[model samples]
Target chain A: MLLSRMVPTGFNDLRREMDRLFQDWMPGDGNFFRPSVFPAVNVWESGDTLYAEAEIPGVTMEDIEVSVVGDELSIKGTRKPMPEGDYTFHRQERGTGEFCRFVTLPMPVNAEKVEAVLKDGVLSITLPKAEEAKPKKINVRTS
Target chain B: MTTATAVEKREGKVRPEPTRGGRIYSPNVDILENREELLLLADVPGARPEDINIQYENGELTIHARVDSRTEVGEAQFLACEYGVGDFHRSFQLGESIDNSKIHAKVKDGVLTVHLPKTEAVKPRKIAVKTA
Candidate 1:
């Protein structure tokens, strides 16, 4: 079947047209509203460890690199392009390319203890708080 | 300049049926068509393979994936909350007829691929010209 003939001109097409217009008007990269960062990240802290998560579908562990230096965490990866063939695209939305994101942690972390895991296309990093950065309990005595 | 903006978040349509209690997101997808079949690829991170459900009925294909909460809200203090963790739901209306028995799907690295083969009647045929 000629599936491309059945492609619908829906809201997504309209949105794409609007984006193209805005991009054409601003060719010098001077626009005030920048696009959102890639690999949108979510970070949280629990107990003495901080966690960061990113959704990176279709990315393999071999192509991903995670590192922590002092208070900065960096994630870098590349998504390979689909194999070339005789297929015709009806709708293209997912992106494929190299992406890198750097996030500054709120507190100093033990870089030696940082751990990262990739599961089900989600990357989760655990950063343990540095000894000096952790909250300490002070002793109370009767005066 | 290698960095590109992530896919925009589109909330899934609210369904009348009861849910397991979490926001519903519409996963980004790409559709491709060849002479043999139509291919659909959807990005659904954090969803287990067994939790995905696909249905084709009335010239419409629907995809739903249930995702378990990764972290408890009361336990962790969010420092930067940019994306939500929840289930995914999306549906597409198909205008061409497909061979129901030949349809198949697979998931790997959080991406789901569904292949819908066209019926024999719709497949393109080549005719030869001969001299009389």
Candidate 2:
């Protein structure tokens, strides 16, 4: 529920990512319904910006693929395995695999002029308002 | 509290910290979820894909990171260091219909993303009843 409210505004997205990455070890076990470590995202509408961001850590801009089909958003990428040799085990955990996720927006987005930027492992895409979605400016003269 | 590793052959004394060497560990992970899927972005800097491990048990997801500090990319002198440099661990609990087998993961930059694909069977399905 809280994930939906994450507004991916520059650094704020960084903070949210830090919290998500560190909170796991900070608490005991039992919260499975937690947010996505990468597959999840937050979308919001404020003023004239319709922002959406996907959490994709450890990956570089070259490894990910993002595109919009109509109102559906798709993200695909692969995670490479670590190269460390054999070692005495204490605790081993981390997920690695091919990932393909899609999200269909309730409302149509501006696909022609969409903007995508990757920063701090998070991908933020700004869907500009289509000419139809933009608020119409009317000239009013004392008549 | 005292912990033992191996039993003593002489006086039945418990083993000390037998496991003293370092190993790869799962880094801390946090996941935020929206209506579509869970957002699993983990902080695992200085860790390559081969150095990390992830697993799912019961309904929880776990991640560990192993540090390889032996190789020093000697560039800058150490002045102020705040980033974590040891083995780390993290996990999360998932739903029954989370399709555990289909769970996917990735790491870009330093964040690890695990995509938990929700089972289509569990998702709300539209059914229409017709009476003739």
Candidate 3:
């Protein structure tokens, strides 16, 4: 089965295409192609585990929350504003606010065995496939 | 009184140097200035501390971060790939002289903060007034 056909990333493709168009029109500046969604994510599957990764820089572990209910996963977090100080901003491209994103799994996963880790500003979640979701091989006996 | 100019997005420009191989991305950054120094914050997720290199020369500051591939080649089947994973490279031109010895930088939660202290002559100073 094709992975792309199984997992649906609603509006992500359209957003990517729009980003590309803007990039072509206005080159050099990186902020022009930023997607409207905060903390872009990538999902892939290997063997019996399904993995999801999101890039949320400058956010501490305590500020972010991850939950998995059934076949749906949610990532919610807030990027706090910079500390109060007397300074003038010449360029402010990074965003600061509350954001929540939900991703639907391609197949049922073992919620009990799910694990998530945040390292170097990247959050990686590992969801193991449920017993029923794993592919099973059938043995044939000659009659 | 604190005054802010129009937010200009033309802060950093991507260099034309060819990378080792693979995709190279320009990380987003914020530049702030004060009476004493200029602060730069950049987002470079998935890049280890050891892999980040910062160099200042010829009135230009360059930041290069090396990131390893998350998955093996042709190993995992991607379902929804939104962002590309690769090295981050960008450079900025400094208009004022910087105190190279006092420069400091640190990375936390994939964000890199660089402190570029302005030279003594460039820093704004308050003149004392006395009654004659």
Candidate 4:
């Protein structure tokens, strides 16, 4: 009875809405049950650089993968479940599975200059914008 | 307290209580019992090792973890937010068979593991069978 109630009633509804949004934004069936993004990430941009951080607990640096292709940055990793044993679980809310998140950068970035780091199970990525992509100020000349 | 009535007592003390002013979220955890000890595994993502606190008193074991706030990046805007960060709090009742003084805790990769050892007298022991 407790387990049944623990499942949020609005979860499926939110999943459906997210599926629709993902379908229009990216090409795919947008399966909501098995989401493409796990270990939710935050992405933001500055003047000449973009930053992305992902919360991935129980994952090592070796398992985390970060790459920049064109204006898109992708983060991929897997969270393996606990070891098999004869232990009874009291409460298990965390899900374990492979996840990949693809984010489109707002500005063009230099892929070669991208830096990624994983510390305390959180992955941070920095992408520097290409020289030509940086905003330039133009001064008007008075004749 | 081994009967069905004991269940009510356990549930009564497990209610979530907010700490101070910030929002308090219950951390996901797994409890395992063996012949020697009870192991508690909790998922407290984004919490630094130094921020986790464990306390035991009067047969009650509690965990308090303060997750560090997100790093501040200048002019950064969140595009999508699926997980909200907050402090974690949870408490469990330990029976008399447990040795509270020997409990140990450690955090790694954002996971906290607590070990609660059973008292020597409470451990299962083999009794000799003899013909009278």
TM-score of each: 0.83, 0.42, 0.84, 0.74
Chain B alone, candidate 4, TM-score of 0.80
The reply for model 1, stretches above 4 Å from the true place, is A1-35, B1-18, B130-132
Q: Compare candidates 3 and 4 on TM-score and give the better one.
A: 3
A33, model 4: CA deviation in Å?
12
**Ranking according to DockQ, highest score first:** 3, 1, 4, 2
RMSD of 4: 7.6
Give all candidates' CA lDDT scores: 0.75, 0.53, 0.77, 0.69
lDDT of 4 by residue, A1-143 (tens): 00001112134335546755797766556553543456566777766787787777778887778888998989888777765666555545466777777888777799999999877666778889898899899998998
Pitting candidate 2 against candidate 4, the one with the higher lDDT is: 4
The best candidate in terms of DockQ: 3
Clashes within 3 Å, all models in order: 0, 47, 0, 0
Indicate the residue-level lDDT of B83 in model 4: 56
Docking class of 3: medium
Single out the weakest 10-residue window by summed lDDT for candidate 4 chain A: A1-10
Q: After superposition on all CA atoms, what RMSD does each candidate show versus the true structure?
A: 7.6, 19.5, 6.9, 7.6
Compute the interface RMSD for each candidate structure: 7.4, 15.9, 6.6, 5.3
Tens digits of lDDT, candidate 4, B78-101: 665555566777777766677988
lDDT of 1 by residue, B31-112 (tens): 7778788788988888888999998776567888888889976989999977778777777766446787888999888889
Query: Against the true structure, what is model 4's DockQ?
Result: 0.32
